[model samples]
Target chain A: MKLRFRDSMNWLHTWSCVVLGCLLFAVFLTGTLAYFQYEITHWMQPEVEQIQHKDKAINQAQAYLNTHTENAPRWTIVPPNERFSPIVAYWRDKNTTGRFSVARLDEQGNEINSRATRGGEFLYRFHFDLHYMPVFYARWLVGIAAMLMLVGIITGIVVHKKIFKDFFTLQFNKGAKSWLNSHTVCSVLALPFHIMITYTGIVTLMLMYFSWAMNMGDGDRRSFFSAFSDQAPALKASGEKAQLLPLGDIYNSAKAQLGHAGIGSIIVSNPGDSNAMVEVYENATEELTSDYRTLRYHGVTGELLHDSGVTNAAEQTRRTMISLHAGRFADTSLRWLYFLSGIMGTAMVGTGLLLWSNKRKQKMNPRFRIGYKIMDVTNLASIIGLPLAISGYFAANRLLPLQLESRAEWEIHCFFIVWLMAFVYPILRGCKHSWQELSFITGVSYLALPVISIFTTSRHILNYQFERDATLLFMDLLLFFTGGLFIYIAYIVWRKGYEPAVIARPKRPPRGVVQ
Target chain B: MTIKAFLQAISNAKGMQILWRVVLASVLGFIFLSVFIAGVASLGSALFHLSKATLMLWLMLIGIVLYCCLVMWIFASNKLMRCSVIIIAGIVISSAALYAGDMLHKNHQPVESR
Candidate 1:
């Protein structure tokens, strides 16, 4: 066989991807789901669905702050939006160090339930935080994996020269060829998305690893930040003694100046101080830039202090990248597109790993065979096993004893314990047996999630159906479909019978050796 | 080229390709498998042992040794004294580093606890 540098790189690309593919798949899957975290949270908590009138929610938040935190150090209030019901207020007391209190608000600015959580936000955080690892380290590890992925993408493009020409190709009938074709189709179709996601993921954490670049370009970090962001200097006030001011005036002033855009949030600094600032951020619906703009006011005097224009081009570009990754600005159709692209990204990595394992098993010795088995176990554990575990977490939430000590921790522990078992089970039983067994287990577990939810929670699908709580129904149906996909994969594995792949290794001799 | 030389060339080529794929698979497979084990063990140990630093030190040490072994298989030509010496040295160095980190972390645990 003639060796080309291009071929070697292609080989490099294939192996690098196969090596890091499972991690990449997990990242993409979780990240995509995280895009609709608000919606998912809304769906999960049926009671909070579209309850608070927008005006009322804001007023309630204001009243609550006036009563409970009139002299608090700082107050941040996130008003209710079309998608969410609970008006949120977060504050820190001057005496307490690094502690913040969270509460819901009514239109009169009174506190509602303080305990109702930021639902999908937890999942969104989980995508980056990951389970069982320190957040910073998890991100660093993810970043390295993503960089390897970027290498794989570039090399893959070079190797598959005809990829562009056969961009739309999808062959469903020819077994392994069909799988390869679908893989190529999914990968090539959303090639740009894959590239953007990988690049942006790295860029998001650029400052952490590459702050020296900023320090080189600009002398100090503050100057570097100020060069891109025109954040106004905060107002200063003297005297510990201060008086409460009406929030309504500042809120109205910001709305009038920003035009048409309602205030999504307001942050009051030194709330009762003479130079207190009230920064009003606009709502999501009015302008595309509403999400980005801020109007600063004198909280004490209700005087308009300063207003930053919606966003500079650079800021807009950054926001757009974040929005694309977040899927926050997208409607239902576009959300689906983001999801499909993410699925494709996951499939691309998954197939790459499968191809790697398939190509390797032919010549591997028994000792090395154990390594392959470990890989297979993890592949099943993370890719097929995690979603199953998350479902278990939710089920545990509904089913576990609420009065139990450290209930939340126990719920999370169940998830990890089950996942750990899944990871090790493949090692104990060997790859083939574990693969078949766990895929079936995952399928059955996911299938039971909604049933368990209905049994445990007061609200049933039928009740939700009557209430026209479409979001809840949608989630339950998605769980069912996920179960079906698992079963389908399990059946395929069963029918095929798990053993070494049938493809023979290429036959050739060295350049100078005798036969 | 002679027929014998050509035939020998073909067989050697086949062997090299098979060896390359096998080595690549084992390396990639081992890398992933190790990371996953390390990751899971870190979390489990954190709750159980009240610290995960020890588990991480062990993982990093094992990883370096495994990596050195893989490189020797892929690149080192001599199947004689060199391979044994290199592997032995790698194991010793990795073990030493791991032990140092573990001891240091243990000694400093009280400070961190406070």
Candidate 2:
């Protein structure tokens, strides 16, 4: 069959995206949520949700560590920030069974009886790690899918000649065309961002696959990394017996050096070593990449020996790419842009997947029919069900008994369990009903989260409003709005009747096309 | 050249249309497979052995190449492009397999010293 180039590409786009659409859906959904990972963690941990006096928080944590494990060589503390609830310190203890030990710190910087909770990290891991597959395979699978996604994006642009012209055009009333139009607009609006993100996300960890480059270079990989480190002098521990200095001094020094730069993390290394050192890296607040300021002080003597800020051009470029992919360097407004672009990317994949299933449903074969049905089921779970599960996770954190030994774990488990039920529910109930019911369920679940938090916590929505905890308030409002979106979707489902009920099978294409 | 001639020139250049697609697909497929294999082999090993950055670079390179191939494919014959893609992807798969074998062999090799 002689196919037009655009028609050929259209075929390519449909099959390529459909092959990995469900996987891409999960990735897009979770990855978008990961933009607000720290905020979600903050929401989950209501206790340290809005921490003030960060200097005190670090001091308290350091004070607790001083009493508990002074002999440990390296100490790293992520002081409770506004984005998370717990003030925990992760350390390397030689005497412990494992090299790493995490402890929650009290207000006075003392160790509190709290377990290390993997809140957003679980979702973070699940996005790339995937289920039933080894993390490496999962990453590779995601990489291939992302590559396909890039292809889809490019072909989609080529096929839609009016992509830019129709940028502001979204005809909601027109069925398939409207969906495609909206998808195209979103996908094209941030096409460059999407392409770069997908590409850099793969590149940031390139050496893992291409070891030939390593063989081509010097034998020592550290030396190779040192090259990429932009020839910044390798940091060495100061060799002098001295007492550990207060973290507050280092914090102040970092701020003074890199005025207004975002503080990434603080590390006081080799504390008990004769030549201990303190290294602090401050992230760039504006750029998409990292240009960090580093100050290495003699650990015990409190003497500043060497200070370096990320000044190299290559390093800055790399940092910028990283920042763009992670969206870590962006302020709230930029983050919202990232979020909007991500939603469009998600819609692009979702509509493409729906179109695939829709087209396939016209076939009468039992095997193909069952396959389409299965695709529909998975689509529901990946699209609406996963978000609903995440909303349930936050709700459970507050609603579950805090005094229970494994409260945090239980909350995370509830999320997966609900997702599993969502997977099963669609298979049993059929696709159309599942779509409408799940949309309604997801809508109600999300809306109920803020209400649940308000009822359970002393700091409700009104309380947050008065206290000016904008992060928490924004989180609640975001949930409410998300709920409203889902409700609107549910209404659409009801108004149109179920999709299966309304979809009339298309007659065979003119003889030349199919068979 | 007329517009049709320009299009035909683009289509006829040495491996111009289909070759790039094949090359791109092969590179990307190789990167994906190799990284996956390397990560699995390096598990429970020293932290120094893990090189995620390298894996990422290769994947991104594949992405770039794939996009380029896709552009060419849009202009080239579907039959020719698909065949080329298959051939290139096959080569990449074989290379990855060979590399994995080499890695395993080296990993098992005893340290020889004076």
Candidate 3:
């Protein structure tokens, strides 16, 4: 029963990956999609495609906020960036103590009646928060899975002694070997990225995951956060009313101070109060480190109050690590690399799942083993089903009535429903039949997205020339590209047949060892 | 081997041993590793006069890699007993160091009322 160190590692890597692979796959897929979330959100909300001027949009937002949110305690203006087409604005009234109320504005600062959809924010949130569950539970579950993934990655490296030698060893149509090669290549090629991502992912929620560590310090979590970001405590709003300085002037001053650094957002706190503070936050995307350079000004007098930048080396290191993990600082090309790397991570998990089932299938009499059947169904559902569900989400976005109540909720419901169906279908119809059928369905659904968009909204690939919005055109092309990949995969699955043509079963070990 | 056989194996003594080893490697090993990192970080903070938050973050960043190494060692060890001994020893040593660091920190600070 005694295993060599390498053999034990092999065992660990296999079991850990199999146990957490499906969730890991979902996480990786959604996280990858989140990289382009803003772009996808823009594509989804086609009504705002006409607003092109970013500076003019901010002015419009100011005018709109002045009239609408005069009595509000706080107002934030998120100027349109490369990904988001709309001038997004939010205000929190003194009466409502909860989250701010959001409004989408156009070039003229008038509210746009956009279609009700969660857009890319859903995918972005779902990446970590997940669906049909409380965020607290979801994050914990995801954190555990990420930790296991880190374990798997390390053990996998140990198990594969010939990692470098096998780096270029890819044999197509070799069945299990092919899958193993793919898994290996994906993991090895992006090994540094995989490590960075897994470690940083854990770090992103470190406060929650290791709350005990924070408790070891000063008990107040707020103080820890304030110390972490190096921000001073905000002064309370004075009751006396005052005439606020023009936002345009404050923006100009902030722009001058930052000197070419893009302003990510403008926060006006305690609006209409004498002690109102207007803070402009610099876009972190311009540099590798996620610098939170802020210039706080007196909201009324336009006088500069405080400017804080990262000064401490330790804090800078921490922020840099976080920024690297988020990839917010990455330009378009670097973002694509991050996306591709994320896709590789996802594929590695997928192949690992398949490898587990494939290795077992080769040795066992497939029909007799209920375990094999379960594995088969799970692999099919998670690997192909989630994508199918995502396609369903997009389709629902297009098909749903514009004025339908809870339209965003319905889109999410449709996603889960389709995903649930995928999970159940394999169990009922048999894994082989379900895999082929669902794969085709997924392929068709994705391919049909462009046509659906053309019918549902004015924003289509055809209308890209009129709007001069490359983001819209690029999104359409990407969808088609993904659809093509799925269709090709479906075609391969159909052509190759359901069951493996040859089963190269490994010999059973002695009674002491399970493998 | 069939599914029945595999299930039977899992219920048997040898399977239980393997299961315990996995637990040791993943769970106890992680705890031991975190404790060790905390102790080291506390000491580092005191020595360098770094803020507790900064040192904690630095330790956490390093802990990821350190934990992986510990896991590898846990699995690679020739005996489960050896792995257990290592983790227990780590916990004991780190706890003492952490306590010492806390005492030193308290002693260095001037008494202040809330």
Candidate 4:
């Protein structure tokens, strides 16, 4: 038996996708949404209004920090940005663990207690960290999935003979042929985005994948990272007490130096020590590159010390790739492109999964093989179930008692619990009914999100507060459109019905059988 | 070739051969990538004036690209035994290059300093 390269690629592409398609779907969906994570966070925490003044917020945050922990070893101040997060101040006391305590400030320069939801942060971490698993193992698993996706994408390109020409062809209702067309169209629509996202996603975790890269260095990771990355070298306190010069002075000097670029964050190391150093990082919005400009100053005197940034072309290329993946520099319009491309990637994976089952159903005798059942269930659960589970997460954020223990963790719990229900529903009710029912339920649930907000919070869609800010209105419109799409899909699935695409072929005599 | 022609050739693969290829590409391909990175770094030290960090990073980027291609080649090649031999030969040759390159760099460094 002999196989050519293209034939082998087809087999590799199919099986690789079959094995890892569900995981890839989840990652692509979540990661794509994370492009709007800041917007999502704004929606989840509706009470926090936009800041009218950036510099004033910084001064207020510093004053508040002075009142709270005067002699704290370190303090970080992040000014309010277009992302809608308030002025945030982070600090760590000597007695506390290494974790910094976060405080949110409103326009009035006073600390405000918003509802206790992880907000967009949970989605951001979930894309890579995952849940119900340790971060170490989860990262490894996600990394492996990313690598296989790269394989699938490359092999997929090789296997499709009319890959480019198929961009013009579509047969809407031909069952298996339609599924193939759907997969091909989605794949072709955003081929570059899929390839770039997969490759850059892997680069984000490449250090972990190639941990042996550490040995090539001269055993000094701190200096190596500082040299190649944007971090300043680590500093320790002198233990001699000294007052920090007003942050406003340092901000003014850095502002003059930075010109048009706004300061994104200010970190002061050893605030009360003689050797205190203040680090100011330039905002990411000024450039598409993730390697932002940095200015370090003497904490007491407010003199500019040094600027830390990418040293050479190699590091710059690496940093740019990561920045492209994160999309942190994306403005409103570019973010929409990212979101739409993400939707395309998710649809590609979804249709690929469905296409697998459809192809098998056509070839095999229609019976209850565990493999078929599992495939059909996964296809239904993942494509339809994920949106429903995400809605459950949002619902939990609104409904859970604010004072409940570990309320944030409970929100994530709601997400997984709903997801598990989605997985189980198909097995009990059978895939045919389950697909339509779950999609319909998911659609209504999403449509009901705005209604739920009306009852649970002060800033629902019907309320007058939306007139003050359009973020919630934007979110509500998005939810309604998504709900409408899901409903349309359910209708289509109901009309077409889930009958097996059984192609009746005449059987040939058994080859080389001894009669 | 058409899709039909390409798919007909898929019937040529055996179950055992598929399993062997998976292991050889994933596990052994990674080993080759690691050694290849070290080999490039060592060889780069004598040739380029770049810092170790920059050298390692660029070599890693190159190594991963090569590894992705190698994995594809491992499956596509009809000669499965030959693919294994090539991977093994890669490991051995890269390891030797690393050793010899390191020695050359060490010998070359002092004279330049003087």
Ranking by lDDT: 4, 3, 2, 1
lDDT of 4 at B100: 72
RMSD of 2: 8.9
Tens-place lDDT digits, model 1, residues B61-90: 344334433532433232323434544454
- How would you encode candidate 2's per-residue C-alpha lDDT over A1-515 as one tens digit per residue? 25688886776677567878988988887888788887776666555535567777777777777777845777877655444545667787766666477787756675554433566777777766776568778887887787677777667777777888887666776766766676776677778877887766656545543454343222345654664443334345555555677787777776787776677777877775556777777665556555576777776667777767666454455566667788777778888888887877787778777766666665545535556667778888888888888877877777777677777678778888888989999888877688889999999998998888877777668677545567778888999999999999988888888657234455678877966
TM-score of every candidate: 0.73, 0.79, 0.90, 0.90
In order of TM-score, best first, we have: 4, 3, 2, 1
For residues A1-515, could you state the per-residue lDDT of candidate 1 as single tens digits?
Answer: 34565765666677667766777877777787776666666655555546445555565666777678645868898766655556778997777767598776555555544223445665676666776778889887776677667767767787777787766555675656665676688779889988877766665664553343233222355654554455689887665546646665566567678776656678988876777888887654533344467788877777777777534454455455554555555667777888888888888877777656655665665556557666777777877777777676666666776466666567678777877787878777767687777888888887887888776666657577644677777888887898888888889889877774343445579888898
Runs of candidate 2 exceeding 4 Å displacement: A1-4, A80-87, A97-99, A111-117, A130-134, A165-170, A209-220, A230-241, A309-312, A363-367, A501-515, B1-114
Residue A512: error of model 2 in Å?
34
Q: Which ranges in model 3 have alpha carbons more than 4 Å from their true place? A: A66-71, A365-368, A500-515, B1-12
Model 2 interface RMSD over true interface Cα atoms: 9.3
Greater-TM-score candidate between 1 and 3: 3
Interface RMSD of each: 15.4, 9.3, 2.7, 2.6
The list of candidate 4 runs beyond 4 A from truth reads A67-72, A108-111, A216-223, A226-236, A262-264, A365-368, A464-467, A500-515, B1-13, B105-114
Model 4 per-residue lDDT tens digits across residues A399-466: 89977888888999999999999999999998878888999999988888888889988877777554
Better candidate number, 1 or 4, judged by DockQ: 4
| Candidate achieving higher lDDT, 1 or 4 | 4
TM-score of chain B of each: 0.37, 0.33, 0.77, 0.75
Instruction: List per-prediction Cα lDDT, in the order shown.
Output: 0.64, 0.68, 0.81, 0.81
Model 2 lDDT per residue over B1-114, tens place: 899899678666755754555445446444444443334323312234534334333333553555446444533465654655664565455456446544554675577721
